[model samples]
Target: MGRHKALPYVHRTFRGWHVRRTWVNTGEVSQLNRARIVSAAIDLIEREGADAVSMRRIAADLGVGVMSLYNHVPNKAALLDGVAEAVLSEIEFTDDPSAHWTDRVRAQARSFRQIAHHYPRSTMVVVSRQLQSSSGVIPVEYALSTMLSAGFDGREAVQLLRVFIAYIVGSLLREVGVTPTFAPVRPDVDVAAIDGGLFPVVASLAGELVKCDHDEEFEFGLEMLVQAMIVRRGARASTSEPPESGVIPSPGLS
Candidate 1:
């Protein structure tokens, strides 16, 4: 059928799910099943990432029939929520909100990096999952609670959380080649063939170039982001005056 005919039914189905989400007051039993499937999903994702997880495979791995899964999960999209949560919870972060915001943020960012290290494919899921599920929101709250306690308003907290997490996770994704730890290079051709009259700087700097570790490099960027955020927070606090009454702020001018 054309989209014009399909659209109404699609909208109604989604509207129906919003009501199904409230089934049984809360998803207590479903949450417990999520705990199981998510555990298996993490292993599958580590081997193949977010795409590797399917209700069929997860149910098989858990030794439960596929129909049994529906009692706990709505569909693959909902199961993805569980997988993302399991990946997030793998990071061993302390939950005490009394810690300084920087310290807590450091821990939060580090934990996410650690999770991404193990489940590289789920990196996409970490920052992108919807908050309708409690599992998906817990780790986010872990980070936001620190910012909230640090006197950041809601809007600022969300902006910084996205910025910081994306910067850190994006940096980690760039280091994918080395994370699972590959073996040394085995060139198919003579190594000296490509060395004809090389750029002197690169030739002379071979030792330093070979010694560089991207994991260490990724951490450095995360450190710089944290420092820059701290500086921005301080600068905002030190502003001499607030905007004048009735003045509308222009975008991208600051």
Candidate 2:
């Protein structure tokens, strides 16, 4: 009778798996998985741009067949979703019941911004995609819970959250120099050539205006929003009338 052969041993790496066969010296064979594929896609995007990321490209990077990636990612849309979720996972939400909700919100915003800064090229993937993963939902739910616990009604919480997200997206876009076609031109203009008499303040501070400290600006804007939320919460507590039948406003309603 023929002896039974042992199966290959699998070694996982951030990009993929290395399969080692004991029977023969086939060296390391690549096996694709969800995490590995998503990571490779992110690396590709960071090194090149979002346009550079594709199943074919990722599979090539992993030294695996393109069809092999389908078992893990299924399709490009699903792969993008996975990539977004992976990016979202980097945001660390602290579980501290004792901490003030405002502080918690501030921390969450800062954590998000830090991740954005770390992955500037890939940040848009997170912004553009609808988050369906638990890793993405958890932080959002935590933020909403914090606001609700601090006495924000459902509508207020949702609206405030939208505003916060908008601010972060806009700020990150500016920081990363990714703007729409209609965005103000950022060309190197001659500040001295501009007539000071026509635009005295802008001309005088053109150098300072151009030299942006994105971190400082983000913090300043976030603090402003936080203060506004605090004031709104206080006013709502004092002056807002209770709804009929204890009904909370639905976020879906206009």
Best by lDDT: 2
Tell me the spans in candidate 2 whose CA falls farther than 4 Å from its real position: 1-29, 179-187, 239-254
lDDT of 2 by residue, 85-174 (tens): 777666644556677777878887887788888777777888788886676676678778878877888988888888887899889888
TM-score of every candidate: 0.63, 0.75
lDDT of 2 at 180: 38
lDDT of each residue in 1-254, candidate 1, tens digit only: 21111001111121111111111322233333655666567667777767778889988876779888888788988777766765554555556555556677877787778767767777677667775554456667777887776656789889988898777766666566523322123233233333537666655655554454766776677767666655555555534333323433333111
Give the range where candidate 2 is weakest over 10 consecutive residues by summed lDDT: 12-21
Q: How much lDDT does each candidate structure score?
A: 0.61, 0.70
Clashes of 1: 0
